[model samples]
Target: TLADAIFRHLDHGAAAGPSLAGRHALVTAGPTHEPIDPVRYLANRSSGRQGYAIAAALAARGARVTLVSGPVDLPPPPGIDVRRVETATQMLAACRAALPCDIAVCTAAVADWHVANPTDRKMKKAPGATAPVLTLAPNPDILAHLAAAGPARPALVVGFAAETHDLERYAAAKRVAKGCDWIVANDVRPETGIMGGAENEIVLISADGSERWPRLTKEAVAQRLAQRIAEYFSPDRSPA
Candidate 1:
């Protein structure tokens, strides 16, 4: 009920102000599960709260949003299309399929590596037996792929960087490496409580510069980001 109320209030505010009507947005969220076997997988602590909030905010502003999410406990936001996924590969495929969108926000905590040869059957354990070794392979760089999508690339591509140290340095490097328009950087160290917590302290990095944002609820962050997106598309506004 609290989330519903928040969404309603934000939606009402967005509807009364700048709108993203006739625009399409693609958002990716949650932690991808890299399977090692039929019953076991690797994942992170992402709760998908921020990504879902962003999707809702964009939808509230009248953008047609397609949310490609990994496993998350939260429900899908209202009035937006949702595509559920598991592995990083699947998430990338789903994102590619939602192409030609005007905006792209990738917030998924996609695993950097996946099991090179996953087994279909559940792995079994035996007493006095050596544990099975897993070989890892690099996962696709979804943000980079989308950024280099040529004619199909979204006009505004945003990516998230969850780091435990050197937030600004790593995020700025990522922006160049991924070729995305912007990078939303946040410290996700355990004490920060951002990995699975409601509040976020972030730095919005772009070609112009970085803006430090105060700690706020994920919903508030989403609303602010949505407003920025709307401004970017506004005819009177200059590109940042």
Candidate 2:
């Protein structure tokens, strides 16, 4: 009953105004794993909390939510459809398959590079203690691909910028480079704990400029982002 009530309120809040009812929202979450060997892999520290919460929020607001996640432990949200993938290539393929949505949120911290070819069997270490060399190749940029996917591109394409320095400067450049409608930028420094922590601070970057958001829990950020997406998709809303 509680979940039902909250959903009802969200529906009313979105629909009473210019809402995203009947629109499809696609979200990517977690970190893609690149296999090195049968027993070893490469990945980041993404928890997928923010992205999953955003999917839940969009679902609450009456959007058809499609979550393409990469090995998250959390269960799928109440009213969202989820597709799981392990590698960056798989994630891109899934996004292509789920194209033409009203919005696409690229929240996954996909690896920039992956092993050219993973060994089928476990790699044995040398008795002399010399480390084995691994060759890496760049992975496809899923967010950039979605934004430039011709007519199938969503009305609003959003990307996440996890940066270490020059926060807004790099974020703005990333937004322009990715060709997305918005980029949610964050500093993942040690104290802030943006990677694996529950709380986060983000700045919204768009064509006009940037807006620094207050520190909040992951759930709150999702709700706020969902609301902004709803407004942005409305017939009367502008980039402003």
Candidate 3:
């Protein structure tokens, strides 16, 4: 498949050299499932394609990649460690457990809130009764926590901002707010075909400025990001 071929190319260093050798990378992907009831939950349209591609790209570049993923239908990529998770809390814990990494990329669309008191039994509908109200509580901020991890923080921390408008403006602010080194901002509006589609058009926002990338397949985006990450850690390479 295209994904396999992309990884092979990177593995061989046909484009750029394997600059990530001897490094460790952590990636989070997919959408967290916030259960509303025993049989119902809230989730987004994340397909985990981009995050999976990134994990593959890093692994191909000889990085020891640990992917912490939420519930998704995609198969695990070869040559990397995978930790499956369900809710935002689990994802946060999984990410922290994979810490002391050189790089961290959080691509999971985590739910901001979860049912405060979810019951194990199935919630039944009562005849002539009104719907039940759910008490929501905010989930932990995984990206921020990692970024603020002090000495244990990764050298480079990347976060994703899936927005529908003000892409550049909002992403720039997110970079500062989250204390991440970079923000991969993309339009997730249905028409953009980015939420669950293969291709993506993104703006790479860093401390310096934002660079608009051309529309490309998720694999291409991953490869490009991996190369940039390699350059960031390359000796004699200046800070961006």
Candidate 4:
């Protein structure tokens, strides 16, 4: 009850202004785990720091933020609604339920494929019986689904591209393929220390072109991105 009251006070504009007071934002964060069995699962290295920061930033701008998050250790940001999920399918469903929002940002590193036939019980070695095979199935593409043309489609949909090679080309192509308004591209190679790290270096690709941003704290990036979204929704700008 104390947490709820605190969040309510923060949501009531205690620290945030009213620039984006009426807007609603939907964000997906963390790494979705695809189950192999009761004891085994597949996941990525995402820490969910960036997405959580983004949610906090948007909330600070006065937008109602609904964060559909995957399994992570981070605490929920104040003045935001956080819905936790474990798989990509669940994440998509949660995102759909929070739709008709003004902004959607897909920052979760969702698995591209999941075990099609997960065992009900824990898998065992059993003295090495030729190693059990795992049939992989394609997971639902949440970003593209949100970017699809429809009445519930958000005005701005942003996706993240964590690439190890050909970052710009791949990110741009992904933007086109996903039909999202923007793609935040980043190098996630282990050497870059960007993945699962506290700082980030990103190149924002949109219809307007790419803008390379300096390496900064994840919170800083979130603030800049939130400011950009606020600018896009400013009263003076003509609707796209």
| TM-score to native of every candidate shown | 0.93, 0.92, 0.93, 0.91
Ranking by lDDT: 1, 4, 3, 2
> Residue-wise lDDT of candidate 2 within 1-240, one digit each (tens)?
999999987664443345578999999999999999988999987999999988988887789989999988888887689999999999999998997798999999999999998999999986998898889999999999999958898988999999889999999998888889899999987778777889889999988889888999998898888888888887777673
lDDT of each: 0.92, 0.89, 0.90, 0.91
lDDT value for candidate 4? Answer: 0.91
Of the candidates shown, which would achieve the greatest lDDT relative to the real structure?
Answer: 1
**131-209 per-residue lDDT for model 1 (tens digits):** 8888999999999999985899899999999999999999999999999999999999899888899899999999999
lDDT by residue (205-230, candidate 4, tens digit) is 99878989999999989888887888
The lowest-lDDT stretch of 10 consecutive residues in candidate 1 is: 9-18
Tens digits of per-residue lDDT for model 3, 1-240: 999998886556434653788899999999999987779997877999999999988887779999999998999998789999999999999998997899999999989899998888899999999989889999999999999958999999999999988888889999999999999999998888788898999999898888999999999999999989988998866554
* Superposed model 1: Cα runs more than 4 Å off: 1-16
Candidate 2 segments exceeding 4 Å error: 1-17, 238-240
Sorted on TM-score, best first, the list reads 1, 3, 2, 4
Clashing pairs in 2: none
